[model samples]
Structures are given as C-alpha cells and as structure tokens.
Target: MDELEAIKVTFFQECEELLADLEGGLLAMQDGNDDGDTVNAVFRAVHSIKGGAGAFGLEPLVRFAHVFETLLDAVRSNEVPATPDLVVTLLRASDVLADHVSSARGLGDVDEAVSASMAAELKACTDPNAAPAPAAAPVEAAAPVVEASVAVPAAEALIGADDALDDDDLGFDFQPMTITIDEQAADVAAAAGNVWTVSIRPKSDLYRKANETALLLRELARLGPIEATLDASAIPPLELLDAEAAYATWTVRLETDEDENAIREVFEFVDGDCDLEITRGEAVATDDALAALLAGSAPAPAPT
Candidate 1:
C-alpha cells in the first residue's frame, strides 16, 4: 500500500487506543472517581478522534464526535452534574462513538436514528428543564448511511441558563486553544487558481452544546491548504467569561480547486449552528491578508 493508505491504517490503530482510553475513563467516572483528570482524559480521547477524523474528511464521524465531546465538556466544567444518569448516558454515547469509528473504517455500520436519539439524550443532560429522551427504538440491522439531506434536530435549543457558568469562579483553565495551519503548503496552493477564502462565525449556542472549533478547522484543512486565524476580539476577560458561550470566531483562507459546494459541504451538519460565507479570491497573503481578514467586518461575495 502507498504511504497514504499506510497512514490511514495507523490512524485506525491509534483510534483503538483512544477508544480504550475513553471507555476506561468513562468507567472510572461511573465508579465514582469523577476527578478532573478522568474528565480531561475522556475529553482528550474524543478530541483526538475528532481531530484525526477531520483530517481524513470523515464528516459523519467528526459530526457525532463533536456532539459527544461537547457534552463531556459540560460535565468537565461542572455545568452538568456528574450524576449516575449523566454518566450512564455518556457511557452509551461512547459506545455509539466507537460504532461511528468502525463504520467510517468500513468495519461496521450504525443506525442513524439510534445515534441521533442518543445524541438527543446526551443533549438533554445539559438542560435542567428539558424532558428526558423518549425510549430508543429497538436496534435494527445496520442501514445505509443516513441521508445527508435529512435534518437532525438542533441540539443547541436544549441548553438552559443553568448550564452556563462563570469561568473565573470555576477555577478551571481551559486547554489553550490553537489552530494548525500548514503555511508553506498553503503558500504553494495559493499560487494556484483554486484558492478560496472562507469565514465562519459560530453562534454562542454552538459551543454551549459542545461543538468543537478546532475539529471544524481541521476538517477544512482536509480539502486543501488552510491558513486559519482565530478571532478572539469578542472574548471577554476571564472575570467576565461565560464558560458555556462561544466567544471566538475563525477566518480561514483555504486554497483548493474544489468548488464552493465542496467547501460548504464540510460544514453540512452544522449549517444552522454557524454563520458561514465562502468566496473565491486571490491567494491569501499569510501575513497581511490573514490579519486584515480576521479583523474585517464584511466578507467578499462568492464567485459568480
């Protein structure tokens, strides 16, 4: 096999390790050892899988993992109490996440309805007022990939005010945020004719629901060279921070020959959760243009 195929194999192998770590960590939490480290470990496992899946353009895997990771973040931040019910729901989510990974690798398939139902249950855990998820239908034989057009109900609507927390008082520092961009490669891609400029601003509810900013950025990188900059201007100081709100936006300059539809497809599942705009443009000047783009208020129009 070529190097690309070999790398894919290694990723799956590593996923097995991550899944194991995820299960063990969840089990520890279930056993009443809900320490910070355990929560972080569980979060990292899902984050790592989402990162790798985004790199490989595994959209379905990334989408579900984002939801799973978001829920874990709420628990880790203590916004959602780590009750037995939440732990049980998270454990089940972990199982579904593993199934998604397996399906991505062509080793197995998962019922879309079941995954959606479980995702709803996980979302409900973050809301004190939301009704409990209805009983899940009995598992049926694995079906074909869920139709991309079918709308999964938005989970953000389930978040309640009680789920929001003051970050300063919580005494928990968030993991430092970073964006990975291959500048040298992007430079070369920019010189080609296929470059595009993409801007994304996710609603505060997006992060509240546990959607991942980093994973989405990584997913865009899968299409071609990407130079991303996080717009932190809107972020309030720690003393004023709302732990559950999304304050940062991203401006990514993507260099790819793929048409607008292809780039838009990267965010298909998150359509309503974010404000996205794509436009054809000259190669991005990494230094000046990236800064200006991130600071600007309006994006250019899409290529006709």
Candidate 2:
C-alpha cells in the first residue's frame, strides 16, 4: 500500500493499541506487576508511532514522539525503573499523544499548556539532577543515559485500583455453530468445524526480535484450531529491516462454532495491536455450547 493507505491503516490500528498498552502499563504499575512484557509493549507502541510520523514528515508528531520514545526506551531497557510517579506521567503523556494523533487528522492543535506540562514532566522523570518538574523547562545540561537498572523494593512501589474483570465482562459468550472451509485449506487448517477467517497486520517494529505474526498465530490457538496462511508477497529481505513492524498479513481460518463476541475476545488484550476481519462459512450441526456457557449454574447430574 502507498503512504496514504498506510497512514489511514496505521492511525486506526495505532489508536486501539496505544490505549490498550496504556491500560496495561497502568495496571502493571498499580498492581506492582512490573513485567518486562508490559513495559516493552508500551514502549513499542510509542516507538512505532514516532517512526511512522517521521516517515510521513509530521514534525509536531515527530518531536513529541522523539522525546516520548526516549523515555520509553529508558523504561524498556530498564534504565529507569517503573515507578508510580512515572506511570502517572506516562498516562498524561498518553493523553497528549492522543491529541497529537487527532491533530494529525485535522482535529485541532493540542493545548500549549498541556504540551508544556508533558515536556516538563518528561524531563523530570528522565533526569536525576533536575529539580522537581515546574511549569517550564530547566536551563540545565541534557541528562545522560544511565548504564545499569535501578532496583526498588516492592513495598515502595505505587499501586493502582484493582479493576475486576471476568470472561463475561470481557464479552466472551460461547455460541457454537458449524462452518465449512475450502478443501485446499487443509494444510493451514488443523481441524474442520464452523470456519471463520481473520486477517491480521501488526504495526512495524511491534516485536523486538520475532515478528508478531508468528507469535500472533500461536496466541490464536487459545480460541480454536486456526489456520494461518502467510502472505510473504510483501516480505522484504532481512538486510532492509524494520524488524519491529510486521508487514506480513495472515488469512486465518478457524474451525469452531464460537460466536463473534467469543472469537473477538481472543484479540481483546491486543486491541489496536492488529487489523482484523471475521467472516462466516458453510454450516453444519453443533452442540449448544452457548447454552452451557450462558447457564449460570451447571445442570444437575441424572439420578442414579
């Protein structure tokens, strides 16, 4: 696709992911669940947005992303530890970035004061010598990137409110049906039932090492038997690499009677992390998994 097409696709995909990532970061920070994956996830989203904006010659976006990327890099590489204070700062930054994304689409300019506050907060979080963040930037030398990570006691970490969620809360309603897949799809497909195909394309530079396509396919298995055909037509040579972004798209055919809501739950945590479509196929007989799923209590055993 051309730049315009790519831009449209990226904005739609990026917005979902950015918010999901922000949610994860907040949850991790609040729960004291400082896993590398959570931090890396947030960083990768910011990094990809910055790279794309740079390619499109969007200076205002590029500028904000540059500073934001630096902060995320620090978090990802463990330069600065994940602190409650930093998490709050990042959340505020997320709002600013959201505005930037909107402004890119001709929404309006982000408030100058909001932008200024973000700039000041970012500097304080990244710099040790800087006095507490004021309403303006300081006239000090740039902070050098530290080599080692900071270790903090778990008890000292800041916490967030625990938001409870269950499968039902997540829109997982198991409605079973049967759909047929093409005979030629046997190689990619593991089983045959109600077939549903999904197409996924991840933002470039999403994964640090392996592309998310393969990783993404593995995760799909949790929902049902999914057949994924790699579209390597756009695949570039390893030498010309944007290893972070995944250009390869997959046509995944899943065999199950799972309803759209049930199937959609598979990609919930990854909202905005991918492009997707789900379509039905030929029908067949199936059990009432939905009845069982929707039933609050189990049926009583037959009298023996």
* TM-score of every model versus the real structure: 0.50, 0.41
RMSD of each: 17.0, 23.5
Q: Please, what are the lDDT tens digits per residue for candidate 2 over residues 1-304?
A: 9989877777647766776776677677667877888777777777677666555545556556656767777887888887887887887788888788778767787775677668656766777664442354343452332221221111122222334545554454434322333334442332444667777776553443112344345545655555466677787888986655577776766656567776775554244557778776522212243234335445454469
- Candidate 2 Cα errors over 4 Å, as ranges: 1-6, 129-304
If candidate 1 were superposed on the true structure by all CA atoms, what would the RMSD be? Answer: 17.0
Candidate 2 displacement at residue 63 in angstroms: 1.3
lDDT value for candidate 2? 0.60
Considering only N, C-alpha and C atoms within 3 Å, which residue pairs clash in candidate 2? 17-272, 30-160, 177-257, 179-194, 204-244, 204-245, 205-244, 205-245, 206-244
Tens digits of lDDT, candidate 1, 153-222: 2212222234465655366543332233455554455566677878889987555444566657666776
lDDT of 1: 0.73
